[model samples]
Target: MKIFPIPCLEDNYAYLIIDESSGEAAVVDPVEPEKVLKVANDNGVSTVKLVLTTHHHWDHARGNEKMKELVPGVRVLGGSFDNVHGCTDRLEHGDKISLGRDVNILALHTPCHTKGHICYFVTGKEEEDPAVFTGDTLFVAGCGKFFEGTAEQMYQSLCMILRPLPKQTRVYCDHEYTEKNLRFALFVEPENEHIKRKLLWAKHQREANQPTVPSSIEEELYINPFMRVDMPEVQKRVGRSSAVEALMELRRMKDNWTR
Candidate 1:
């Protein structure tokens, strides 16, 4: 399986997951149809079999209809309650979708940024390592705002559902917010060498016009503040004992934080 990260509006990203064996592809959160189609064609993918939407946000699912119009019989999949535009298939937690002979994607219902947001976990015979396409629910060093759910819900979504994944699992989130997120992480843990080193690395990547995504779960465990809510420094910074309280305070701090 091959994953191509297509940059969309501003910092948003739309991924193209291709099955090399059959040259079939699936797009995740295609904000723009033309860009995704162009990438697909460039990579020799003749058919787009599926359009997987992580949420109903315009920047994520706006191009669903246009993509379907272009692909003819492409299936649009989203959370059961998302009511995403152009969604033909309603998926619940643990629902599996096969892309080709080698690639299979499992939908994980992780609602926080939106009421019905879901992340796709891709694993198959062709992949060297598994990957999770965490739309806006999880970022490289930060997380999405609680637009529709509470801090506790976000905690469960990140810590319970995502944290347990293999350390080498690559996280393909939907935005390029790594640098800014690392800045906040530094504030939360000023002495953390991991956060400092990652921030510097992200800066270099941005300077070279490279994408700073596809961060491994191991990297996130070391640098991401949201994932480290239980750490002594993070708990002390937030002045909270419980993970939920720490997460709540951290989210609030991030909202008003500025570099």
Candidate 2:
């Protein structure tokens, strides 16, 4: 199994997950149908399936209708509240969808940034390099804002929904916000050497016009202060005791943060 990162419009990222053995592929949050189609054609892969969206966000669901037009009878899977352009499967928490012989997609209801936000975990594959397509719930150095839910929901989603995943799981977020997020991480945790190193690496990657996603959960746990709101250092910086309170403070800071 291999994942291709397709950057689109501003900062949105669309992923193309291909099963090498069967040549079957699934598009995760296709931002543009033309790009996805071009890549699929160039790679000699067939788009027989698609994982539509985690929510109704325009950037994430915009290309679904057109992609459906290009690939007739493509199965589109998404959360119930997504209202995807060409959705065929209405997935809920704990639902599993088979991708190939042993590859399967496990839906995790991680609603906080949005009421219907869901992340997909690809499992039962070779290489043991499992991946999670977290639309906006989790990022390389940060998480999404609390748009329709509270910090409590965010904490539950991260601690309960996402944190338990394998430490080596590669997180494929739906945006190219690593450089910016790492910058903010540096601001929040100036003494964190891990964040400093990651920021330096991200700076070079962005300078070279490269993607910085597929960050491991272990890396996030180490450097993402938002994910470490329970720690003493983060609590001291945010002046919050509980993880949820610290998260809220961090989010409020990011709301005011600007590049």
Candidate 3:
């Protein structure tokens, strides 16, 4: 399986998950349909088979109608609870779908950023590494703000649901927030060398105009303070005892954070 990230709007990302065995692809948040189709055509994909809408947000789901108009029979899918603009199908949690021959997609209900935010976990039947499209639920070193949910929901979505994925599973999120997120991670855990190194690396990547996503679950555990609320370092910095409190404080701090 091959995944291509297409930059859309300001910092948003649209991803293409292509099954190599066949020239079929599933696109995630194709907010810029023309660019996405251009990339797809550049690759071996002749027709896009699926459209995976992560949330109901305009930046994420705005181009669904255009995609429908572009691809005649493409199956557009969104979470069962979300009112996605042009969704042809509503998906429940744990719904499994196949793309071409090797790509297997699983929908996970991670609903903190939005009430019906769905993160797509994808794996290949062959030897390809697994991946998860986290939308606005999870970033490189920070999770999304509590827009429509509480701290407990964010904790459950980030820690309980996403934290247990395979350590090497590549994480793909919705925005180009890695540099800013790593800065926040450093503020949360100033002494964490992992965060420092990753921050520097992210700096270099941004300077060179490269994407810093596809961060592995293991890397996030080490550098992402939101996912490490139980750690003594994170709790001490946040002055919170429990994980939920720490997570809430972190979210508050991030929400008010200027730099």
Candidate 4:
């Protein structure tokens, strides 16, 4: 299983998951159809299937109708059918979708970034680690903003839904925010060596114009300020004695951040 990270529309990402053996492919989060179609066509893979949406946000699902039109008879799978454009399949928790030989995706409903956000877990065929498509829910160094849910919901989604995944799980988020997020982490935890090291590494990756995604969940636990809200140090820094308050503070800080 080969996952291609195609960056789209002003930091947004739409992925192309290819099955080498069968030469079949699935597009995850098609923010733009032309780029996705061109990539798939150039790679000689069929772009007749898609994992429709992470949420109803335009930046995430804006290409749904165009993509369906570009590839007639395409199967558009999403979390909800009501608001989703051209949704042919509505998926929920514990649903498994097959791409090709040795490629199976398990959808986990992680609703914090949005009320209907879902993450896709895909295992690689060879020695490669498993990959997760965490659309707006979990990023490399930061989680998505709470647009439709609360901090408590985000806590559960992180601590429960995403934490249990294997430590080596590669997180493919929907944006290239690792560098910025690491900067925010530095502001939050000036004494954290883990964050400092990650920030340096992320800077190098960005300098080389490479994708800074597929960050391990273990790394996120150590460097991401949002995931560290449960830590006593983070609670103290946020001027809060409770984990919930810490999370709220972190969220508020990120919301007001300019740089």
Query: Candidate 2 residues 91-192, lDDT tens each?
Result: 899988877566788889888888878899986567668999999889999999898899999999987779889998999999989988999998889988
User: In candidate 3, which residue pairs clash?
Assistant: none
TM-score of 2: 0.96
| lDDT (Cα, tens digit) per residue for candidate 3, span 80-161 | 8888999998999999999998889999999888899999999996567799999999999999878878899999989999
Q: What lDDT tens digits, residue by residue, belong to model 4 across residues 195-244?
A: 99988988899889888887888888899888888899999888998877
Q: Which runs of model 4 end up more than 4 angstroms from their true locations? A: none
lDDT accuracy of residue 30 in candidate 2: 83
Off by over 4 Å in 2: none
Indicate the TM-score of model 3. 0.98
- Residue 86 of model 3, lDDT score: 96
TM-score for all predictions?
A: 0.98, 0.96, 0.98, 0.94
Q: Tell me model 2's lDDT, rounded to 2 decimals.
A: 0.84
- Model 1's alpha-carbon lDDT is 0.93
